[model samples]
Target: MVHRMRLMMRIGRSFVSILFTAMLASPAIAQTYTVQAGDSLWKIAEKTKAHDVTVHQMIAAIHENNSALLGADIGNIKPGMELAIPSQTAASNASSKHATQLLSGTGSPFSTPTRNTRIDSIQKKISHIENEIEDTIEALTTSQDSFDAMVTP
Candidate 1:
């Protein structure tokens, strides 16, 4: 009886160890998200809370996982469309791989302008508009002068 008990204990320990290992080895199951009105990929990614990945990475993972449903246009998601939210580990892996590509100067799916860049862009546009206004005033003055000369004669 003593020998049998020890053997059974050993078997139980082995079984527990195997179960734990299998659980860790398996990938996390993905959850499904239903698209809502006014929901964009960016908004969905932001609200999903996938840890260890940026919103861009989450967006890319979502697009990759749901390519069949999303098709070529990521922006065309409509209300009631279901999306598989990638597992946290999957998103982390995808984002890490994508981050390397992005850091190496590869293109990103989205671009966010820095404050300075936006300010400079606005300044340039303002300068161009001012130049256009000045040219218009000069043209109008020239026309008026021509009219005055003709009327005086």
Candidate 2:
């Protein structure tokens, strides 16, 4: 009976350890947000609390997540709208579980050299992604136009 008790305790400990490990290792979850009248992207971003990606970083994510809000400018998003938010987990995971989230765009005017460097790097990435999106949009528009031509004639 003592041996069985010891084995049960050990099993319990192992299960607890596994549960803690899983909690630590889980990916950030995604969330959905709605825009309110007078609501801004910056405000919504403030709520998301993602580290590496800013509210702006999510313009792409927003469009991808909420198919209904397409073509709306991220910078000038209106209120009374709903948006998809990235789980803090996914954002953290995207940065490889160790990546620090980006400093908020509203950081102090006294920016450090490191901040400048990071901004440059992020801007480059954003530019690349924007170019890709534009190319895709162009391709899709072209296809649509061609199809329209084909169907009309």
Candidate 3:
């Protein structure tokens, strides 16, 4: 009888473990958000605090998860447009992918210099201007001193 009871206890423990594991593996359910009169993607994202996702990430997720419903330009979503908010993980992944693509792809036409390069260039221009100003001031000072000497009795 003791052996049968031990087996039953083991089975119960296994069942509980299985249930717990299933719960953990379950995916987060996606939610739907309807656009309000003055609702923007950012506003909606801010309102829906799903796992602390950012507005940009939320916008990307909405665009990707509901491409058919939202259309290509997620920015052009009108009032009363219903959007499907993705799970946190899914939204994060989609946002990351979108950002990567934007950076890698031809998003901007004009080429921008690196931060360091731009700073260095600005510093150089400032240095040149300062040198020119100093030269002008020195020339003016010398001219004034000479003029005063010539004028003195």
Candidate 4:
């Protein structure tokens, strides 16, 4: 009887250890946030800082997790959209990608890569791009005018 009791105690300890290990190994379940009126992805991300993610990261994570619901443009998000709040690591990665975009001047509406950029540099870049676009449009309009003039009676 003593030997049997010892064996049962050992088995119980093993079972408890297995249970504890499994609980620790399980991944954390992500939380969800529903979009509200006048809410932007930036704002939602700001609120989700409680989850320990930066606003930029939160925006990126929300965009990635809800691409189907949000469609292509992050700026196109609407009221009542349900977004998944990603884990901290995932949010960090997303924010990194967004930061890259910002640095490359491909910023989304919710975020500008200019967070670290000098204000004067941003203005100059914007001015340069605007000038290039205007030149292209003017050239195109001139070519069209020439074609019209030649084709007319």
Candidate 5:
């Protein structure tokens, strides 16, 4: 039982360290592009094809990243609107991540699931950490009680 508790504590610490590292290593600062007059999403994607991704993929990524600014109708973007353009590698990774979540039955069916998916994942992690903390507290209380009983005699 003691060994198991030690292992659990170690795992918890490792998980926290990894989570912190990932937070620090957030995706590189996204490049921002300002919409120009008479420019369509397709045109922007084509002109900014710095990565190997297809025009469709680039447009989807740009829309996903800037959904808040683009609003419900991405096609209605106006001139001077700045959009965050994610790298192709980042876009590809996000696409694959979404696919994996869908395959695992944990993804939303909506076209834009990036924000929701991240929130769900973070919530799940928080729940798991809460459970682990409760377990650790119980174990520590039990150990303290055992020590007290032995000393009182």
Candidate 6:
């Protein structure tokens, strides 16, 4: 029963993979965005129709060009303001990826790759130390038993 279930899943996955690959590889679909008045950063992001969250980066870029817009007042967005929507290309994807990576407590986003490497290294060291400790305690117990036996005799 489980074997059949696994087989079905594999077939379904391959079918979907081929379908989507053919879809994306074909002509690119053009997306359109209309600017409306009084739209806030959060509002624009919510409307972008992108699968991934891109509102924060869009808001960041908007503010970069116009620093005066960064005030705490969220009620002041003018109507019909033109804001450029960012593409989810490799450049923008990095920011989103980094943002997500941060939420899981792996490490700093911009840290040297060495930091990530060291985390794995530390984990390996901890596992090795635990194994060594277990072995040492077993050895100590055997030696203690032998000493007790000798003393008793």
What RMSD does model 1 have? 18.5
lDDT of 2 by residue, 1-153 (tens): 999999999999999999999999996565667777554444555567566665444533444455356333334345666677766544443432111222332333322224333554587689999999999999999999999999995
- Name the best candidate (by lDDT): 1
Residue 128 in model 3: shift from native, Å?
A: 34
Q: What is the full ranking by lDDT, best candidate first?
A: 1, 4, 5, 3, 2, 6
lDDT over C-alpha atoms for residue 15 of model 3:
100
- For residue 78, give model 4's deviation from the true position in Å: 1.6
Better of 2 and 5 by TM-score: 5
Name the 10 consecutive residues with the lowest summed lDDT in model 6: 109-118
- CA RMSD, predictions in order: 18.5, 16.9, 15.1, 17.9, 22.0, 15.7
- The candidate with the higher TM-score, 3 or 6, is 3
**How well is each residue in 1-153 modelled by candidate 1, as lDDT tens digits?**
999999999999999999999999997776999999767666687788466678768866887788799765566578999999988767765664553332232465434433433454477689999999999999999999999999995
- Candidate 4 TM-score over all chains jointly: 0.49
- Of models 5 and 6, which has the larger lDDT? 5
Task: Kindly list the per-residue Cα lDDT of model 6 for residues 1-153, writing each as its tens digit.
Answer: 999999999999999999999998998554434456445444555576256536545444333333354333323345665444555552244354443332232454322323433354476689999999999999999999999999995
List runs of model 6 lying over 4 Å from the truth: 1-18, 49-54, 61-84, 88-153
Q: Which stretches of candidate 2 lie over 4 Å from their true place?
A: 1-5, 17-30, 51-60, 92-153
The candidate 2 region of ten consecutive residues with least summed lDDT is 96-105
Question: Per-prediction count of colliding residue pairs?
Answer: 0, 17, 0, 1, 0, 4
Displacement of residue 69 (Cα, Å) in model 1 is 1.1
- The Cα error of candidate 1 at residue 90, in Å, is 2.0
Q: Candidate 3 or 6, higher lDDT?
A: 3
**What digit string (tens of lDDT, one per residue) describes model 3 on residues 1-153?**
999999999999999999999989997676888887656555666677466666557756766777787543434557888788877777666655563332233363323333433454477689999999999999999999999999999
TM-scores across all candidates?
A: 0.49, 0.39, 0.48, 0.49, 0.43, 0.30
Model 5 C-alpha lDDT per residue in residues 1-153, reported as the tens digit of each score: 999999999999999999999989996676888988766665676677556676656666776788788654445567999888888776654554543433233555434334434455577689999999999999999999999999995
